[model samples]
Target: MGGRILVADSVATNRIALAAILKRGRYNVSMCSTASDALQMARAAPPDLVFSASELPDMPGTRLTERLKAQTGMRDVPVLLMSRDREAGDVVSALAAGAEDVMPQPFNELALMARTRSLMRARETDRALEQHQSTVRCLGFSEQAPDFAPAARIALVAESRARGIALAAQLKREISQPVATLDLTGALAEADSAAPPDVYVIDATLEAPGDGLRLLADLRSRPGTRHAAIVIITDADNSMAVANALDLGANDLLLVGFQPQELALRLKNQLARKRRADLLRASVEDSMRLAVIDPLTGLYNRRYAYAHIAQIDELARKTGRQYAVMLADIDRFKAINDTWGHAAGDAVLAEVAKRLRDNLRGIDMVARIGGEEFLMALPKTSDIDARMAAERLCALIARDPVRLPGSDQSTAVTISIGLAMSGAKGRLSLPVNTLIDKADRALYCAKAEGRNQVTVSRTAA
Candidate 1:
């Protein structure tokens, strides 16, 4: 079926014209002569796109837009405004009132078609996004959480056959998805063809040879099922079952013998809590990601680099070991910006940052401190190791020519690096800033000697 469209206009002629155009395009069209009628139709069943005239018989188009947006389910629907006035302020006002697009009087066929197509595409995209988000939220993964694809299979484990049947009924009634229930004693191995349940609920009691607790323990031990959210249903109010369940890695515990409302509430609450935990985890990951990441180049930022160095320094002091820091700078970066463009300069910086990150070990931290400057913290590394790492990074960057995006042109980017180490058994007392300064001084010496080389900081006497 073609896309659905709602066309609202005060004049019958304009409505007829738009309906004809939409019909020619094989779209399902609904016509309303007033804002009130349009709103009624929209509430009855939302359309893919709404086109309303600026002046409606009952209310202004802007007011209608606001009202439509205020209503649940209709807020995300796109509203396009049509006006006879060509004034910029009028267009701006309509947009501010939540109209996704506006077309002045004497709408050209081409412009109308283009605007209609764009708004429809945007609305479809938004619909897909909302549906995906809803699925994620249902499964206890919020927008902030890591990417969790929708589950194709669902599993429920209950000891009582009657209770299992009832729970399955409730799931089917509450959620518009397929769900399968299994006796806690049933072998999970049997469900190998079906994808593992994204969520697993285990009843505390089992009619099987062994109790459900054993099954829960067995599932927890299996590496494949370790990440699944496990909800344990129990009648046991004592601390032992709860503690044991938690110790066995159950994500939640649901008490049985409650009213249906209570059971549903508990289920919903557990799901929400799981989603919240996932969101928090994602937030922490994103924070950690940003902590070391330079926004422009996607490299680690200075704060993380400093913290990494501090950690290494502490470890080295305790173990009578040594580590090194490398400070690097781009030579004549300003000249490139002046001659080519800030875009070209940015390209060069990004390339350099990529090279630095690529050359470092996974445990090593590479951070961009400022414009054209970077720092690397290497743990369990000596001065010589640091020098070698820096030299390797410099050589790699110097060898590669950075090709600017959207352009055929390539530019040479070179880096000068400085290395410094904390002496072993001397208990390096230098602060993070001091260590960076020592590395920076060496970097300056390298730059002075000649660009694109690595220099070591003078060893402490």
Candidate 2:
């Protein structure tokens, strides 16, 4: 099946006709003759899209839209209203009342199907974001609502500069946000300091027939504009162009040129949806960072290090390359904390982490696995190279003194390191815990020999 659609029309012929068209497109259709019934049905099980005629037995389609918008679950569902005639006021009113788009009868079957598909695609995107957000919330991390106003940025790209300017001027009257006019060159140009537009109104037949369509694909490929809402303006009779436009990632479309009020409503709807998605994406990134990052030292935490080591061990077994695991402990960290206080000890840990990261190769893994103990992994390393790296880490820490936060005084710091390898090439790599244990024993030997030095495991050699 294509998707689920709820169709509401008082007229039996109208309901049958619309349902038949949708059924041919493979959409699962549910029919209702009154607005109240439609609302009740939707409450029981929400549909992907809602299609209703302007006049119902109990309420107008706009009233239905308002009611649907009020419901928390159905707020994101797209409502398409059908009007008896293409009256500008009715279209504007319907859209302003929160209908996704208002179709004037008798609507072209091809255009209706294209719009349905586009709306369904958008609805699915919203549902996915919402589901992910719910999952994040279940993990005990909730996203804060965005503080900034929803002042969406708009870009108008037309066939000519004059047309773009004219459209921009008209759109400015309908919406309060900033609007800019751009040519094809400007539209596809590389990003700069200026923020990318939140919604782009692009002409489908710019200089040539398919030029705008090509531009749509290019914009989607670009990282900066890929998530922006794209609305295509094409001829009402251009069925093929409309189909291709929706297929190429156009979020919405405007046929029969721009009607300022209708266009404004569509732009606003798209902006709201885009902003919600952006919020969800940001929340996911923040949650992931919190899960794997050490707050004090700004290094990967023990959990992340353990998981990474498993991957590295698997790779070494396949390639038959030796890898190194090292456990380093700050010398007399408890003494520092006892003498200077916890703040100074924290400062030392942060500085030591920085030094270790700076001295190691980019591919090396450095993580703070304990209060003063750090874990480091180096792939494809020999025992001699591992010992040299460990020595370098020890020297780097002892060479400098870290200043206490909010204090002028500085204290010298040093770390003792123990290194172990995953055996020579052509041998199976040791288990992650086994390598870690060997490194730990070597570290004990280092502490016994001297406070600040490097030691290698005998078995590893």
Candidate 3:
């Protein structure tokens, strides 16, 4: 509501009307008559939102939207379409063409204001999410145990040493960070170094004993820096070089002879892209965590457990190795909730999940399948190993009392475990449900024998 809005239309009257409306609503409005002019204006000073008529003097509003979105920084700006045609099909087409919203002409002022407010709110939400995701990713990167300095690092591998050094200096000045430059001379010698820069800017003209493309491919293939962003700078605007760069996962292609200012701008654009990609990756990981993780305990939930078991079962069939499944349930867990309240129950579950994680091998999968039940899949493990692991887990829980925060009482808890193992032939081809059922039966047997014990299915032996 407080920021600038760009209103573009070929028709003077339409532009004036929209500008007046936006101005009356306390928005700073910029008016333009052509798509090309709108693009220039938007790029120079991007508005909070854009309202463009479908028919522009130079190009269609759809094309304008596409062009603006294709640009480095303006991709996320919201564009609304205003057209006189007003047909449902036209509105659909405009939206499909990248307009965030479409309003038919002969518009109602109230509806227009409402839609504008909604779009603005949506944009603000998206921007906040993007920022949060970026922060989370940067935090995650920083928190890695090895403490890699990815944020402050840059690498420039170039053919022309003088040009590369000059560009590296400019880049360091522009970004206010140090950059490391390497040429064909240093590629093989320093390839195994512990620290690789976050970004690799390669000169496409580098001709060493091996192929230049192969060098790019090798840099990308390495585990330490596989995820680093790559940029290819070429002397000629060769389509082949550009295509090869793209094929080898180069993030951008830049012409070598650009002005210093232009070079800085291009470097800034690539850095922005790198930041956005980090944000996107964090968002995806967060979404995945929400989908499959139990919020209370930081363990995988039932759905993910099922999926993991199915995959492991298939792998067992192919590899012909023994695999084990274990189902664990806290004994008399409902009484804990009833006696101490749900908060205490949650604390108990959290403690149990932590113990399970701490006790198991890194490759083992453990998940919460229900309120007080958990499922663990141990691959390449026999029945004896599974029973030994379960016994240790059960003994630990029985001996350790969970101390709830802000409470004076400590509640002792115990777990019953049921384990099932596939035969030496490795693959049971049994349905996930059937495998779970076997473990569930074993769990029942454990409870029947006595709580705080481990029981293995007879079939498993």
Best by lDDT: 2
lDDT digits (tens) for residues 1-461 of candidate 2: 55679999999899999999999988889999999999998887678899999989999999999998787689889999997786878887988898877787886887788788888878766654554455456556666876886577788889999988888888889889899888888887632325788888899988888999999998888888989999999886788898889888999888865578888888988888888888887875586478767989888888767766776677577546688999999999999999999989999999999999988875577899989999999976778888888998898889878888898899999899888889765766478899999999999999999879988899876
Error of 1 at 62 (Å): 74
When sorted by lDDT, best at the front, the candidate numbers are: 2, 3, 1
Each prediction's RMSD to truth: 24.4, 15.1, 19.7
Q: Candidate 1 at residue 48, lDDT?
A: 80
List model 1 lDDT by residue over 229-341, tens digit each: 67777653444565566656665555554334433443443454445444554553455553445779987566555655665676566545577888899999998899789
lDDT (Cα atoms) of all candidates against the true structure: 0.70, 0.84, 0.73
lDDT, model 2: 0.84
Residue 321 of candidate 2: its Cα lDDT? 66
Off by over 4 Å in 2: 190-194, 292-461
Residue pairs with backbone atoms closer than 3 Å in model 2 (clashes): none
Clashes of 1: 4
Give a tens-digit lDDT track for model 3, residues 1-461: 35568998888988898888777777778998999889899878767789998888788888888898887657777788887665545554655566664566766665466556645644544454453343344344212223232464677787767867877887766676567778765764345578666667777767653255667788778876665666677643254565556656665555545444444454554555555555565563665476667999999888767766776776567546678999999999999999998999999999999999999975588899889999999877877788889899999999979997678889999999999887677346667688789999999999999889988888886
lDDT of model 3, residue 326: 95
